[model samples]
Target: MSTTTALPHWDMTVVYPGLDSSEFAQGLSQVLQHIDELASFFAEKQVQALPAAPVLDDAFVRDFEQVVARYNAMSDEVRTISVYISSFVNTNSQDDLAQAKYSELQRGLTLLAQQATRFTAWIGSLDVEALIERSQVARDHAFPLRKAYKQARHLMSPVEEELASELNVSSGSAWTKLHGNISSQLNVPLKIDGETKSYPMSAIRNMAFSEERDLRRLAYEAELAAWKSNAVPLAAALNSIKNEVNVISRRRQWESPLEASLFDSSIDRETLDAMLSAARASFPDWRRYLRTKARLLGLEKLAWYDLFAPVARESKVWEFAEASNFIIEQFGSYSQRLSDYAARAFRERWIDAEPRPGKRDGAYCASLRADESRILANFKPAFAGMSTLAHELGHGYHNLNMLKRTALQRRHPMTLAETASIFCETIIRHAALGQVEPSEQIAILEASLQGSCQVVVDITSRFLFEQNVFEKRQRRELSVDELNELMLDSQRQTYGAGLDEAMLHPYMWAVKGHYYNTGRSYYNYPYMFGLLFGLGLYARYQQQPEEFKQSYDDLLSSTGMASAAELAQRFGIDIRSESFWRSSLDITRQDIDLFEQLAAQR
Candidate 1:
């Protein structure tokens, strides 16, 4: 019942009670000395012994693990400091020293990367299997590290690898930084209610969900118009980055940018193919859902802006306390472990849920060292924002599940990472639908359909854009016109017969920051892959609600160790088989049909 105007401030002192703590300074000094020792040892000779192998059972192995443990402890400390500084900058961008420290920390990371790469390459030459075979934790970790070495090793000769690590501080990484500056600096000039106004991309985009159709339409038009002014700069950055990917992929003898991405993700080709096949097959059902949505809004056809437009009688104000309780209770019914995590997340002040000025534009959950997670959000206390909260809590739960994992194995692939978060959102929303009145049910259904379209349609468009752009960049640089053309073409293909073509967004590629990562290519498909995969898992949950909980928890916990296909195999599902994806789409289609029937009955 309370709407607190000010968001609660996080206490970073939980990690380090004071910046000047003797404990921290001593730990830092110890870690730096260890790194110095490692560089000294490796620089002196080729590896005669492996590092950190408990199985080796000699004085050298003991020395190595002790140093590694200390290094890891310091690594965690540095990351925690960087995270706190970055989060502070997100809320207070005007803090020049915070920004400066953030930049310095990133540069420090690049230097650390060179050191780490040299050590890893040295370790790769050793008989790692023998050492790991002696220790269970080491044995469990061998494959993932081996995979990393295999991917990066091919990309450069020993000298080139070392050089690239050093030069990354200035070249490809700099272009990404330039791209971020352009986006963060953009301002949209608009005419609102017969008055001239200026808006940020974040503010104008949020207007697409305004209850007033006139406001939504005006905001959409004004937003698109403003992007025209900065499109050229954004396009150049895209071309430069894509060109960088093409050049590097070829130098490394990679078949394609996508191949590099898949290799890095540790997912096989057949598995990815099956995920795409499932998404394409469900287009008809999604289209049907779109039509139902249009009819409910009394529009002849849906436009891009209208897709997220709030439908009347579907708008509801959900109090934060009630929403939190609802999510906890529903998730508890699914698994007590999940419920306990959610409960603690809220009670422990782990979540920053209130909307405020100077806060970052989106939501994220940052997993801290050893059994802790911090969630940051600009909460509006609406149904949609609550869903975002629940979605992020799902991420917190994943962190909790993987708390015991070593830092190295804990970094799961992006595609598999979405499983728990989306599953939590589904559990909460679907449960709310069952308990709501018919009108409210209609609203809930609308929101669900809207999200499904984003994963399927919007994500497909991004995938197509990246694919074509990479191909074109391989041949030569694409002009702004060419990029715009590709963006529109991709939108038409994915959003076929659903969206008003004239209203399609042609500057989408220019705006989304996902494309700016130099090392990570084809970041688009992961969202679609994650969504459908989670939906497939949700179907299993429905079939045997009691049995699915433990297996689901096990799946999240094992993400650090397994591939997408391997994880699916544990549930008796073959990810490479198209039929498994078909089943997930079938569930989505059923929902679309139900929405249509409900609309018709009304």
Candidate 2:
């Protein structure tokens, strides 16, 4: 195990010396002033949604461009300051100053949300084609413009929209914070290795990857109990958040929270339906892989924790440096640009790879300023840790290509945002295969399959669970047992006979922070979108590396400017076509076939 003290803490001096520094204070003031400027501009132009045409003249061009310029700069400024302060808060949840700063910034974020909604509603009132024909700026941003215009049909009254935005700060946003603060600080009481230790939830969760069945079982039991004891608050938080989404979605005339999520993710109903249909078709294959694993372990079915248990002859040790080197090298085989960007990230101390008291669990890559990014992870000397590191660095690589785009252009939706990361992960996994021992091969194959199963199968469960929860939330609040039952039913539907029904993780609703999010509901499916979309791209890269290489970076850079289908179309992918998603699922099926082949050797 890697000690927290031994891991690197990220350097944010690239953005500011410190929060108390004059530079930091100045940046904060500038964002405030910019907000004021924007508000005045809105007021001066009487920028409410007009029932008339888009004033498609030189003055319209001037106002739209001016708003774009100010809004973009302000967005970046706010993001820089937000990410900087959050670096400290996320790393040390106990930091009072960081917590205070974050709370202060929430006001700014809320105001920004209000302004954006107002702007979108105003744009929604316009005829998108006339707006584009009237201005060069509009033509350049036709995608978001068109989207805003379409979304206008769903807008509430301006007063209602503003009220909803403000209430979200205390209502939805506060509930999310409560969940984060509690979950991050939660610990499970477990007696392990002859000592009774109160382990943090993340540490306990990590035990799921242990080779020892007893350890995994103990940890699983402890985790469930911990979440159970904490269920009241967690359940309340979820109910509050989901109900808020329901109310807001209803007010906006969305059929469901899933409908709102689709609009937010820049995906269409057809694409999602096709993806889910293909995913359903592949469930049997995933069950075969799971049953094989269970058979290898001499069990009829896998317990929830056994899903990630190592079935290889031996687990490989991976120190942080070794893992970094392997990922960089593997990435280099695919793209020198990706490899070099990764090297810079590590060299510049751009990652905080440590799990410590007060530090949050899991890993994420957040953009700082310009194209620079900071990554956070809980380092472990195992394959899972290394892969997670590579996954996050892939996000950094995405941000690297996002360099020099305006704020709006760089703002990729969740569906497209996972593209570069998944692509990079596939590169690493592919490189590992065909170049290792049978034991090592089994290990790699099982790990890869584990992820695919989650993205395709487990994610389906989450989607169903959340969708049902959202629907039920519209009627009334649910008890913890209800949430658990919903979760188990979802798991049973998707995982089928692969996992022991009795051992299914009913508390998964409490475990995943995704479900607690008020804004980004149905966050689970985007991983599926990314995985399938990325796999399809990887297939192309193999067939035409040179041709694919040149256009790949451009595709990532323009994620914000195009719809998901439009981006896929540039590369001859029809996202709405069921066969397209099936092709991606076929790649996973091949992995299952290889796993079956290798299991026979054992």
Candidate 3:
């Protein structure tokens, strides 16, 4: 087994010098001034009326851009401190200063939220089309900004919104703390190699994906037992937060939580349906792959824990540096610009790769002030780790593209957010598959398809579970058992006859944390949408290599500006059409066929 210390650690000071330096402090002070100015202006003038239209006055345009620039620069400093503090906290949860810094930052964010909401509400009240008639750029951006404020307006009655806004600092967001506390602090007592050791749930739960069946089963049982102990409280946290979302949705006049989320994501109901339908249609293929794995392992049926068991006869070892080079080289072949970006990020220590104590579990890529992107991961030096690097690097690529756009324009909808990362994985996976032998190909394919199954089947189940939980929780509180049943039913619907009935994870309602979000409604479908969308684009790339490059870049570059469907239309892909999504799934089906053929030969 690989030691955890082998994981990477990031050095953020490379982004900017000392935070206490004169220049840094000056920038921070300037941002504070801008925030106060904006807050006071909005608070005083915009009572029920929108701020002056930017299009009608050139002075407003210049001032507004200045306002944005100041905010962006300020945000960069704030993010630097946040990334530094959070990174430290993740690795060393015991660090007092890190915790202090984090708390201080949270308080600061709460203030910013209040200031931002008032400004946005003021903006959303303006007649966007009329305002935009005067300035094309302002007009072009009007719809998205107006839509954002409109969503913000739904939080509460102006009075209740104010109250919730203040209360969130201590109460509503506390739900995440509950989930995180249980997840990060819970220890699962595991017997590994005749030694009984207490492994934190975050660390040992990942072993369920191990190639060794006994280890996988042991880990699964232990994880379930640990979570079961805290199931009631977990259920409560989920119920309370989800109910909060429902109430907020109702007050906003939104019909359903799903509709509210889709509106926030800038995606429509039909596109979501199309994405889900395509995923549902692809399950037979996934089941076929699962059965093939079960047959290889000489088992009668596959359980949830066996879903990620390796298929290749050989286990390839990858060191961190080797994995980095492999990913960069593959990405370089597709686009030199992208390759260069990856090179700079790594060379400059922008990524915190080496895992250590107190570092956060899981992986994420966050934008640093829209000027840079920071990637966090506990890399394991396996095929999955390599793919994770590609996946995260894809996010970096996306951020890089969007950074050049306006501050308001830099924010992409959640639905299209995963495009570059998934696309990058597709590119790397296909390339690696072509070069490797059949046995290696089987391993690679299983890993790839298993990941797809997660976003498709598992995520869909989450979508359904959250939807049902929210609906019921609106009227009443559900006991832990009720939530578990809902989770089990959702899993059954998505997995169908593929997974062993007796082995379904009911405590999933307690485990997966996406439902706990107070803001977004269905944080689930976006994963499936991004996967299929990227694959659809990848399919086009295969058909028209050169032409697809420009088109693909253009699509990613405009993610902040266009609706998800509008972006799709640029490539002649109708995202609302089930046929388009099906085509993407068809590509996955084709990959599964090749996987089965390779597995049988092995």
Candidate 1, superposed: residue stretches over 4 Å from native = 1-9, 16-75, 134-137, 354-358
Sort by lDDT, top down from the best: 2, 3, 1
Question: Candidate 2: how large is its RMSD?
Answer: 1.7
Tens-digit lDDT string for candidate 2 (1-602) = 44323678999987789877899878777777777777778778756778776556788778888887877888888888899999998888778888887888888788888888878888877777877887877787888788887888898999998998888888888888888888888877999889998888888998988878999999999999999999999999999999988888889999988888899899889999999999999999999999999988888899999998988744467778877899889889987888898888888999998787778888999998886899999887767677888889888888888887788778789999889998888888887776678879888888889988999999999999998998898889999999999999999999998999889998999999998888789989999999999999999898999999989999988998999999999899999999999999999999999999989988
User: Candidate 3: lDDT over CA atoms?
Assistant: 0.76
Better of 1 and 3 by lDDT: 3
Ranking by TM-score: 2, 3, 1
Flag regions of model 2 displaced more than 4 Å.
Answer: 1-5, 20-22, 313-315
**TM-score head-to-head 1 vs 2, winner:** 2
Q: What is the lDDT of residue 341 in candidate 3?
A: 86
All candidates' lDDT scores? 0.74, 0.87, 0.76
For all predicted structures, in order, the TM-scores are 0.91, 0.97, 0.93
lDDT of 3 by residue, 1-602 (tens): 36433555667666445444566456445555655665565455443335343343666655554444554454555665567556666666666765665675676666666755655665566555655665566655765666765665565446666677777766668886677667766778999899999887767767866779999999999988888899888878887888877777787788988888888788888888877887888888888877887887788888988887876554666677877788889888899998888887777777777654445577788877555778888777677878988899899899888766765676677888999999999878988888787767787888898898898889989988888887888789999888879989998998877889898888887777677778666878888888988898888888898998877777787888878888888889998899998899998889888877876785
Q: Which residue pairs does candidate 1 place in steric collision?
A: none
Which prediction has the highest lDDT against the true structure? 2
For TM-score, candidate 1 versus 3, the one ahead is 3
* Every model: Cα RMSD to truth: 3.4, 1.7, 2.8
Measured by TM-score, the strongest candidate is 2
Q: List, residue by residue over 1-602, the lDDT tens digit for candidate 1.
A: 23544545556667655435666455445445645565565555433223443335665465545544544555565556667666666655555666665675665566566656665665565556675665554566776656654754554566776687667667667777666666554566767768987776666777788777888888888777767777777777788888887887887788888988988776878888887877887877787787778888899888888988766454467777777888889998788888888888888877776544444566788886677788887665567777888889999889888877666667688888889888999998888888877777777777778888888878888998999999988788888778889999998888888878888888888778889888788887887777778888888888888788768877888887877778888878887888987887777787787778778866
